[model samples]
Target: MYTVMIVDDEPKLRLGLQTLIPWQELGYEIMGTAANGNEALRVDEEQIPDVILVDIRMPGMDGLQLLQEIRRRGWDTHAIVLSGYADFEYARQALQYGVEGYLLKPVNKEELSALLQKLHQQISADRLEKQVHQDAKSPEWAVYSLLSGSHDLANVSIDNLAKSLGMDWPKYQIVLISFPGLHPEEDERIRSFRERLVTAYAADGQSLVLYFAPYTVLLLANTLVGDFGRADLYRELQMLSGEIRTHMDVAAGETVLALDQITNSFRTARSLLERSFFYDKGRVLTLETPESYRQAPSSSKDTSLLDGEEVSFRLYYLVDVGHAEGIHSLLDEVAAQMAIIGKGETEIRERFFYLANETLRKVSPRLWSESIYPGEPAQFLAGIYSQRFIRDLVGYVTAVMERLARCADYTSRDNEMRRLLDFIERHYYENLRLEMLAGLFNYSSSYLGQLFKSHTGEYFNAYLDRVRIDKAKELLTQGLKVYEVAEKVGYSNVNYFHNKFKKLEGQSPSSYQKKS
Candidate 1:
């Protein structure tokens, strides 16, 4: 089905479009609606739609401008502009931006239906043309179909596809190789690595590599290959996994099972792969690993600091100000505390729910605009329950906070300051001076300092020092020596680091470490 997104500032118009269109019957799905261009772009990043119905004029970014930005991003999306009688000139400009259709402000059902019908036909024809041009016998495409839930083996001949690849095995296993944080440009390197692995394992070309998510690949390996039995195959796969871990620095998870059981095996392997988030990137696991090791994670961090009134107050204020790093730091502290208390999933979820609700209360208007009100915490709670681990909970809560934070800081000037703050938080350990930032942002150092002071109620140097000190405390807790901590936090002189640490923290680094 073709996915459709509506980008209009009018909530009433958005609701009407969503309800008025016979989307399902027309072979389209209403993916979502966005209030403004900024929100639409963010939503599009998460789920890129095939078509966007946009208003000609909206706050922050107009329809034509949004379409231009989308084109600049090289998104393969069609646009349909919603224009008023007075917006004829704007509509003409939108046509220049590659708008496929146009609708009047008070949209007529008949015209909208016809437009949708034409778009659907075009989309279907495009897909059919691409499919005809493409090679369907490719194993990667077959595996993609299986994983993406687009394949129905009951109707289609999986046997024929397997035979086309010269695979004649009674049993097949799925091997997942994940390169954490690998970008798009690195796919060829991963493909080359996978080819090397396949050559080492399946000399008869029984194994096929499929590109999955970014940073992840799936290998369809025939487990019944060679004169050796399944047991030997398992050992060989394990050794190969070790080589991948050691040489490629890739996390590998494998489940050896029959061809009919590929779906279930893939799921199990994915679950096993989730374990990678806990360990470093290169950790490997197989079906033979302990079940407990493969299960949801538990933390052993201290939770005492989270119990205090000050931490909660800071957390609320941080969320109010769109402080992403501060929220992350607070969540890490909370997670550590939960770990030490040995809280199970239920208690952890409840604690996080409370925290998320408090933050949402402060920024709900920024996220949902005017739709949010009292006695509606349930809507916000929906996104929190699916988390399976402490990291998952932290990630979900942080994403929600960041989304709201962006909205809260949506004004042009506020966004610039927010980006500046983010840069400071990320690079606090570097030699970041006020002059460097001033030059970078094209502002005089004094004016930049004034802006920083006015917004944060602290001098730029002071804020940078605070961030650096906080990082130093964390490193010291990790057992770095005083001199090392000093250098790590951009302090060249150890004595200056000691003085700053004593001034802010009221103790030496060693004393703080020991007390903690």
Candidate 2:
């Protein structure tokens, strides 16, 4: 369907045109409505529509100036001016910028429909004429045009183009090859497999070879001569990749008996080659691999398989325990797995940023004090996001991890132990438990229990009960009810709270408040 946009200064006119016009019945959908020229320009930058209806007599940046700027910017969108009886002079100058025509302020439905029908027919006819002109250039251009979807895929057109090029091949398949870290303008393969193509398939110079940078596409023209199939093609491509110590994917689709199917085969091969991230280097990826490997979203990441927070916690724990070898191995695994799931560079950067900013900072808070991620937190987050590639991002994150592993004893020392006691003293009215602290501090529950007992001369639960009872006594002395003070000190059952209070202070809550 054709997309359209309306630009006018009056909000009422914009709404009237949007609701009153039968745009969908006229083979168009209003993509957006803009109240000014500046707003219209910003909308078109994201997605340009096929046609635009703009007002001629607006306040700032009138339709004539908007049309002129559209022309100067080479937008190439068909524009129609909304003019009144007094603005005929401005409408006349808009024609010089290739506007379709001008419409009166109170536009009639018949005039707009006729102009749109004429423009649609002209657009379709011009596209077909351009394709026919490109198809008749040469034998190679005709073959390339057909493979690249420039020509209309009519059976008669394909037969005629094949006869004119003096070709009789009945089978075709596409093989896509890519060199990850090399210049595409220069190819350094042994050409042995390409020689095999000439001997078995396209005997003449009929093989359509095209280079789509970083990838070389081979549109193989086959006959009924040899038993060469896609499996044999992959075997030969593997040998070539192994000898050169480089990586390539032999992602070939099934052979087709029609020339029109070459486009589908080409697209399929390109999609499958993206799955090579799961395989090792110096090998090929076949059609046997599954299409997707990304995991589903979850909140708690301890059980999740592919969440970025899993890596965040794992790195922090390993750094806390001083496992140097485990940290290095995890860094490599994360990069490879993200590549396999088809994550772009931007997504990889954000994932690594969570690891650095949220989890790893707790281990060594001063870890980049003379920091790469300096200034405010926004500057620190942007520092991780400024990397241009996966290797550079991995290198930066690796440096941070190595630095953290050396200086990661923030919570393991005596002063930090005092800090933990201060944390409990500050948040004792809330529900506090040793298991929660173990997870937050990346320590074992049993180990943390023993440490708390040695430090405070009481078990973790008994110490928490005493802290809560002391706060409850203060609230009771301030004329709070027994049940009110019980709930305020983190107790849902007042009876259970009374039992704990009597055990700790040798008195019931009502008696304690009366004595105070």
Query: What is candidate 1's lDDT per residue for 1-516, written digit by digit as tens?
Result: 679999998889999998998887777889888877888888637578999999988899888889999999988798999976566678788888888988888999889989987887777556644663385656666666676666656765667766766664666666665554333223355556666666775465666655555333545554433324434544554465443343322323344444445667677667766653333222345555442223323532333455744445445655544555556656766766655555556776777788777766655464546323333557658767765445777777776665555454435544657767876886688677787565445568999999999999999989999999999988988988889999998999999999999999999888998887
Q: On residues 446-501, what C-alpha lDDT tens digit does candidate 2 reach at each position?
A: 99889889988998888888889999999999999988988888888999999999
Candidate 2: regions farther than 4 A off: 1-132, 135-150, 157-259, 269-372, 379-458, 470-498, 508-516
**Candidate 2 C-alpha RMSD relative to the actual structure:** 12.6
Name the 10 consecutive residues with the lowest summed lDDT in model 2. Answer: 296-305
Candidate 1: minimum summed lDDT over ten consecutive residues — where? 291-300
Q: What TM-score does structure 1 among the candidates reach?
A: 0.35
Clashes of 1: 9
Best by TM-score: 2
TM-score of each: 0.35, 0.45
